[model samples]
Target: MTTLGLIGSGHIGSQLARAAVAHGYDVLVSNSRGPDSLSELILELGERATAGTTADAATADLVAVAIPLKDVQNIPADLLGGKIVIDTSNYYPRRDGTIAPLDAGEMTVSEFVQAHFADARLVKAFNHIQAPAITDDAQSAGTAERRALIVAGDDDDAKKIVSGFIDAIGFDVLDIGPLSASWRIEAGTPAFGPRRDREELEIDIAQATRSARH
Candidate 1:
């Protein structure tokens, strides 16, 4: 069984934990607040899940970074090293202050995070999906049908690993090239959390993908 670690047991982290357990993966979840704070969630996740400190959680086969963008440094580098990290964080200017690279269109959130955690195999995912939508319903619901999940990473093997996890959780995986191209799927973009059907998501990602500059 793949051991999944989660740094930051907030909305997305908790949801990912739940989904992972639902798919039979062992999950270790934690936040800045400590394991005691997540006792209830751990209990709810049953034997498949456990709560630990942020650093401990970062040591699993797959680690998820779901905390606020500004606190990325708080996650110990040693823990994130050599792990495939799923980045679901976004930069909220009001809370994270002004990030010049993001504002200048120079780097996406995952690009900055990857630079900070150089040893980790960083992949941008869960950032484009909504908390409620991802947590609720198996894939899609109502008239919407099911849409694809977009993932961007520099490592093909790492992306394939994350893509398998994504498919297990219910949605189709749409590979969106590398981390540098992640800006198109970031929060404010046309493809971000649009709740489009699978076909529509394909179209959105296609339109958003920029051509390589010569």
Candidate 2:
């Protein structure tokens, strides 16, 4: 059985943990507040779920990062090195403060995160959807109009792994090229929110345009 580690048990993280457990994956969830703070969540997740330190979670088969963008620096690099990390974070200047590259439209949020965990096989996902929609809107594979989630990463194998996980959890996967091109689904883009199938998502991606940094 695959172990899914979560590095932040906030809205998105908790939802992902639920989805993972529902699909028979053991989940290790952790947050900045410490394992004791996650006891309730673990109990709710049942026997398959365990609360652990961030480092402990990082050691799982796959790790999902659901923390605020500003705190990416706080993630332990040494432990996450060479791991497949699903980055479920978005950049909001108001909350994360202004980043030069992001403000200049030079690098997508995923690129910036990749730079921080240089050795991790990071795939940008779960960032474009709402927290509640992660499980609520999921549909089985082959279901007509099944919601599609976008994934962008520099590593082909890493993207494939994450895509499979998405499919298993009841959604379709849409690969939107590399991490550099992930701006198409960033917060301001048309593809960011809403539940769209593959075809509709493709159209939204095509219509995405970067507004002036200001």
Candidate 3:
């Protein structure tokens, strides 16, 4: 079983932790508030789940970064080294304040994350979709049809590792190439949060072929 680590205890982080626990993965959750503060959530998640400091969570086989985009730099560089770090953040100028380059379409959110967490195996995923939808694994298993999630990373092995986790959570995985091509999955793109069926998602991605902003 994968020992999952979460580096934020916000909505997405907390919900994803529950899903991971439900799927039988051992989870270590953390936040900026300190490990002791997460004791209540840790207790709710049961024995399979535990709370730890940010650095401790980052040391897992796979780490999910669910922090606000602006605060991502606070994550220690050494902590993320050589590990798969899942990015589940979005650029919300009002709440997170403006990121000039991101607002200008000069850099994708994932690219910014990679630049900050340079040593980590960064994968652009779980960003376009909403956390509520992500929590609903049953949405992926029903006959009514569910959408595929985009995953972009330079490393093939890391992408596969993340894809396996995606599959375990009941969603289809769409390989959108490397990190440089992540603009295709960023917010404001047509593909972002489109809960269409798998075939629809593929076609949507294929048809609107604009050059992704570097």
> Compared with the true structure, what per-residue lDDT tens digits does model 1 show for residues 103-155?
77777889899988999999999998777677574562233566678889999
Which structure is stronger by TM-score: 2 or 3? 2
Q: Which stretches of candidate 1 lie over 4 Å from their true place?
A: 140-145, 209-214
lDDT of 2 by residue, 156-195 (tens): 9999999999999989999999998898998878998988
Arrange candidates, best TM-score first: 2, 1, 3
**Considering only N, C-alpha and C atoms within 3 Å, which residue pairs clash in candidate 2?**
none
Global lDDT of model 2:
0.92
TM-score of each: 0.91, 0.97, 0.90
Residue pairs with backbone atoms closer than 3 Å in model 3 (clashes): none
Tens digit of per-residue lDDT, candidate 3, span 186-206: 666678786766677777666
**Local distance difference test scores for all models:** 0.83, 0.92, 0.81
Predictions ranked by lDDT, top down? 2, 1, 3
Among these predicted structures, which one has the highest lDDT?
Answer: 2
Residue-level error in angstroms, candidate 3, position 105 = 2.7
